[model samples]
Target: MARIKPQALLIQSKKKKGSTRVSLATIITCNILVILVLLSLYATYNHFYKRPTSQLGEELMNTENTKDGGAVKKFDLPGYAIIETSKGSITVELHKDSSPEFVDKFLDLCQKGYFKGMLFHRVIKHFFIQGGDPHYLRAAEGWTLQGKSNGQLSTSLNSPKHEAFMLGTSKTKPNAKGFEIFITTAPIPELNDKLNVFGQVIKGEEIVQEIEEVDTDEHYRPKSPVEIVNITLKHEP
Candidate 1:
């Protein structure tokens, strides 16, 4: 080997050390980047797939629920009803297993054209819209039907939750006729166990939202009536 100068050796050693430091820095940076990417992926998965559905938040579902972005699960209920309204149609899935007598009576009434021309008399935003009074025909004289007594009102609290789009009977009040029905605009915990939820809006939830948003009077009655044009029943397996 040629005689190496001490200064040249020192310079060579410093260069080697600098190159090693650069490689180490590069490896550390790559590792940090990988970690950050993994964390980001996990967070996204959790947000979409593992997010809990029990809490209320800016998401209307806390009180007002919308459809889950996932596949729509089919429900095999005993009966279903398509409520044709002035604004649109709302399809309700009845839970006869939970509220047998109530469902039977409601279906009987539908078969007899009891709900036709009934006005959605009461509408409270972010709360619910009440109808099926069987006797509310104020402004909508021609479009409204005079409902007869539903006889003895009967229902069960064994049904599903009082969540948004749930079809429930009137609250338990002194001498409540029980023929008055309401659809929840949100999760109403206060009405839970105090009323009967006999059905759910499987379709046309937007119509319910539209009805709930209608202008209301001081008594929560809709200023402009939202009429139930008719109810078509479906006996499903």
Candidate 2:
């Protein structure tokens, strides 16, 4: 073969260098894309599947440490209610600061015995235990009333953390209605400010969990009736 020219050799070297640079850049770009995809997948899993246990603990601690600080007009007293259930009793502390109206209505209903002997009509494990539907209780008594108005207690969406034992009112309007209430069995961050969070369990969390873990029908109604035997209010001076 004829001897290659110096310029030709230099040009070939430059081409080789350029090709090497392009290959390195392609490899780096591919690695970055793979890393980004993995990061995105991790984030998605964290958001939907994985419970952020540490974060939840922090939030719970914050909620526990929260004080009323005269946030709303004080109730007649500061205390909780004892909900006597067939399974056990649970004590719930009303969040009067954030949801004064809802608390007042709940207290009024409790005092009126509206929740007496009401079945925990709906319960989902790791979710919530619901009751306070007088209609359901009446229907169980074979006295179904069609179009009979259930007692309505007006409420509004309140910004309270929906953690385990937090009480939420069923919404009839966008942000109103409080005849039915549910006690969360776990952190329900999705319901924050959507449901009227009126109270939280101050005692007997195990009882709440026990009710939630009870066997239920396809409609989530408890197979063995878990009734609210009574609700007795307490006042602290």
Candidate 3:
């Protein structure tokens, strides 16, 4: 075997050290890149699926009350409404603090008997049941109301999420909602910020669920007519 010289040995040791350093540097870079990718993925998951409730609360708080200089109204006590339907009655607690204008308009319509004998014209399983359309009520009389008393409420809280048993108003135009309202049977996050959530079912949630189970056509109109006999509002003392 040939004996290696000291200089050649030292040069070989230096080459080994250089290769080791390069390998360590490459490993550290790869580890950093992996960590960065994991962090980005976590952020994306938090943004879409696990968004914090505080963020949702902030959005609700930031909602613009567009009632045109009308002061934010507050109820002395929580108010509730009894929705007498063909199936059964559902009681909803109005969120006056969060949606005063919506609650006010709804109560006004109820007092005016606008929803009397109105059909739950639209219903979707695991989604919602919509009613309070005067057009449908008038249609039963062989004519149409042409959207009379269908005035929209401008100041209302946008529904950030549609929780089960929540009441929401339909938005026909930007930041405007009319007499059409709905009750949710499931969590519908897609309806967030699209509809105005004004109340939540405090009693007879089962009745709302029963309504959803009703058979409907492709257009979601109930096969058997489901009518709103009347809606009565009561204030809690």
Candidate 4:
């Protein structure tokens, strides 16, 4: 019935346009948030849910590619094992016959990616670098069968006999062989034939000494963290 002022109409139109722009911006922001949530869900599923089963059949390869890898030989049992660390490496001789079950179990853990993110948990300058406890893994608890007998960490294995103590720590008390191996920084004359000597460091004792010489607290853990980044087992052809 009445004519509206042109100036007032222009102002009203501008306000309507500004409201439209705000609505569009809000929608765009919501969409972006939704996309981010989806991406996060996918990443979580990929990491925690999926397992890379293809590597099982591909035969172990030498990832270290050094003397550590060179000194390894194929023994009657699995021989020439390599543990490449960020700090250094320790190549061990697997005891197939003497410590058959435990040795194979240890190698099995190495076969999987179990040792990759694990660290040399306990380092007692002269005692040894005590690792192999599942607690040291990045995310341990939920993990199934990480080479440790029983679900927790075992400090001892069920070896009927004992061997040289200086070779490594077997914790022969009763039950203590989950995954802990100690490198002798200082020779202990007492442990020579009392503990089960499974394997020895054919090479890389220098790295072993470095691990042994680290300063330790009352708990015997090094003041610094030494990681065992990789492990490769070389079998005889």
Q: How much does candidate 4 score in TM-score? A: 0.49
Question: What's the true lDDT of residue 58 in model 2?
Answer: 58
Q: Model 3: per-residue lDDT, tens digit, 192-236?
A: 645679998989988988888999876667899999999888875
The window of 10 residues in a row where model 2 has the poorest summed lDDT is 139-148
TM-score of every candidate relative to the true structure: 0.55, 0.56, 0.56, 0.49
lDDT for model 2 comes to: 0.71
Alpha-carbon shift of residue 49 in model 4 (angstroms): 35
Kindly give the number of clashing pairs for every candidate. Answer: 4, 0, 0, 13
lDDT of each: 0.71, 0.71, 0.73, 0.58
Reference-based lDDT, residue 61, model 1: 22
Native-vs-model 4 lDDT? 0.58
Model 4, backbone clash pairs (residues 3+ apart or across chains), number: 13
Q: Could you tell me the C-alpha RMSD of candidate 2 in Å?
A: 20.2
- Per-residue lDDT over 137-201 for candidate 2, one digit per residue giving the tens place of the 0 to 100 score: 32222111111123121132242376677887754443333377779776655555346787888
- Cα shift from native, residue 135, model 4 (Å): 3.1
Identify the superior model by TM-score, candidate 1 or candidate 3: 3
Instruction: Report per-prediction Cα RMSD to one decimal.
Output: 17.6, 20.2, 19.8, 18.0
